[model samples]
Target: MTAVEEKLQLPRIYKQTVKMALYDLCIVGAGMMGSAAARHASEKSGVKVCLIGPQEPKIREIVSGNEVFGTHYDEGRIMRATATSPLWADLAKRSEERYRELENLSGVQFYHEIGALTVGTRYGQFIGRTKSSLKGGPKGYDNVEILAAKELNDKFPYLTFADNDEGIMEKSRAGYINPRKMVMAQIVVAVNQGCDVIRDIVLNIEKLQGVYKLTTERGKIIWTKKVLLATNAFTGMHQLLKNPVSYKAMPQTVTLAAVSENTAKRLSQMPVVLYEGKGGESWSKTYPRDSSDNIQFYLLPPIKYPDGKYYIKIGHSDDILKGSLELTDIRKWYSGKGDEELEEELFKLLDTIFHGVRFENHHGDACATMVTPGKQPYIDLLSPTLAVALGGNGYAAKSSDEIGRIAADLILTSKWTYDIPKENFKVKFHVPSKL
Candidate 1:
């Protein structure tokens, strides 16, 4: 047998005890970080990893001749940048390769190589800095470039901005990941590697002498000698940290609508655009989505001008977005009623690009932004048995898999082999008075 077969046939960590099964590592939340870590750890190394999430990632539909998850529709957080730590950067590069390998191994196409652009009306815009980071360099990343307004328009005729506008361009090194499909693909890889993934919500983790007892909502018990808290966005596992990484979960809502194929074609012809509007107006959550049956997705500016650089738009709770901040669900994105002024502004936004349309505001009303007060990712050994990972507000999709891999390395080997400072991984926030 070949080395690959030999590895595959090799038995996993757990022999299945009567009271609780054992795993090399038990991960919570099967989203971007957790799923990638499980898949990468299982395939690249012999780590027997287990992932448990509230929902199972559906993969067969996207591949294997069945559209189970629907017509390749996927929209989620954007992954950008090359990575700050060498360990992370290299892992990110490998993850891109791994994404292809996953296609080769599973016969599914989950990634698009379209380069991303971050348009800034002025300096101090961190998204532009993030685009430059993905370019990869010492003076700055070589893969990234600063595009003058003229060059920007020439490269992407669909995009227009103020004459003084500056943009950060990463040539093909960055692109959006179909977040939902990406999650499914990674979990598929993990399960194929002899790892067991059960669908259940982890309610609590109790330290038992040297081991951890994990209780699930299904009443199933799982025991692991080690645990990795890979849950991001919103899962209160931060309390489990001996050195709990800190990230503020700023709930946000995005207004999504689908236009005709013509509109999509026009927008698709344009490179992914992020216009930080002039007059202090800014658009943080908008992108030309070319990968789904859901038409296009966008987050319009709250006001004609963003009085501040970045601000979270908020509103009352609803079904999917109970704590929604989306203006599309109730307020009109086109001209209408009490919000006519805001509606007209958004209509002009579309008029600048496409024609003809239908709209569906599919996602839940509430979306969450995992913000790090210091603007960085937090990776650390929270305890001897617990490891924590979060805060990818910058470009998590481009970085999470690799970050997750480093996190696994740190957890399994007991040290941060990379050169990133201790402060880079831990947050020193003031303890709350009335918790």
Candidate 2:
């Protein structure tokens, strides 16, 4: 191992009771996708499986150390079946169909199926493309209602939108999922199906004669017939693969504005909103291409947080700021507040959208998301004994259950069983010269 790897390595604890136990498959991440894959793999294949990943740190201070973090630590992630891509829309529709089933089976509640609204310029191609993608896609776009600015403003009086912008409201199978609770639900379901959960960070993976060896930070070793890498933003770390996969881990900031109970009640009918409109010069920079005309802001209604306060949260679309590919930089990035100027910009954006709503208090936090070349996840097998199902590209949270199901099916059956073409998710490897 290199000197940098040694500095982050955990001291090996030689367990006196150590025994080289074998598993049919071992998953290297226990986040949304990994946990869902574990549930599917164990329930469908009846194979001995192990899900390994460290639990989320109880406080933000722990991120100062060499710790792994998850973007699903938040209370809400947008859930919708309509998208610009047919594949994503299909994946989301499949996953949304199982929300009730998963909830009843695990006896956990994570989905709040209120509704979802997306507004964009009438002249832009986004609204038309989304509608077209949904016509022959999943759910047939019947539940989506197209409304002009007048009808939209009359329906959602609290929201302020430009006259030129139109809206699409998904009446069903769309809303927000509490990601933290969603992971818990998956873990519960997976555990009920006889999958072991290992709460430790994966330090290394090595291939043996017929199985792969997994080394945890605390020195626990597991042998499995196959391995699935769902490590997301941390995939390049730990040198699990011979060649690193091509992906970007971009820094993001979300601002949460606390609202009073009365204000929350007034906005109770608010649907998860995605608005594409103009951008300000200070925060919006043309990166990779001209994005000034394509700036998007996603908003989640007032949801109660762990602090017992109700707050509305908002985040900017990707490619607005530069990001890093270094493990050390990504780790350090999570230790502090994200772009302060961006946070202020979000505050103003929320005020402008919400009209007369007054926020009690607001704060910004740091997060990172993984993006792939095609903006779709890579659910492919690296080798006969090793597979990978990662790279959410920001759209995987709502579609995670379906993605996991596809991955589990691939790894267990060694077949591309999904209706979508396998070529759409082929993994590509390219190490970037600079972050």
Q: Best candidate, TM-score-wise?
A: 2
Shift of residue 169 alpha carbon in model 1, Å: 2.9
Q: What is the Å distance of residue 89 in model 2 from its true position? A: 0.8
Off by over 4 Å in 2: 1-20, 62-66, 136-140, 279-290, 431-435
* Cand. 2 TM to true fold: 0.90
Clashes in model 2: which pairs? none
lDDT, candidate 1, at 150: 80
The residue-level lDDT of candidate 2 at 42 comes to 90
> Across residues 1-435, which tens digit of lDDT does each residue of candidate 2 receive?
333223223322111233467999899998899999998999965599888887777666643454788879899999997788888888998999998898887777889988999888886777777777776542455788888888988999888777778888998888999998788778777877878788788888887787787888888888889888899998887767866888888888889999999999888878999877543233334312225556688899999998889999999888567555577677766766788888888887777677668999899988788889889899997776678899898889999999899999899887788888999898888752111
Tens digits of per-residue lDDT for model 1, 1-435: 334333433333212223346777888766677777777667646566777665522332223322111111234333344433444444467667667776566444456666656665556343344443453342466667678778876776644455667677656645655665576666666777866776666767887778778887668788887887776644443344433344555443343333444545444423454544341122222322222211122322111111222211112111122232232222121111223233333444444433233332222232344556666676777666677666655346656677777777777776778655656766433452111
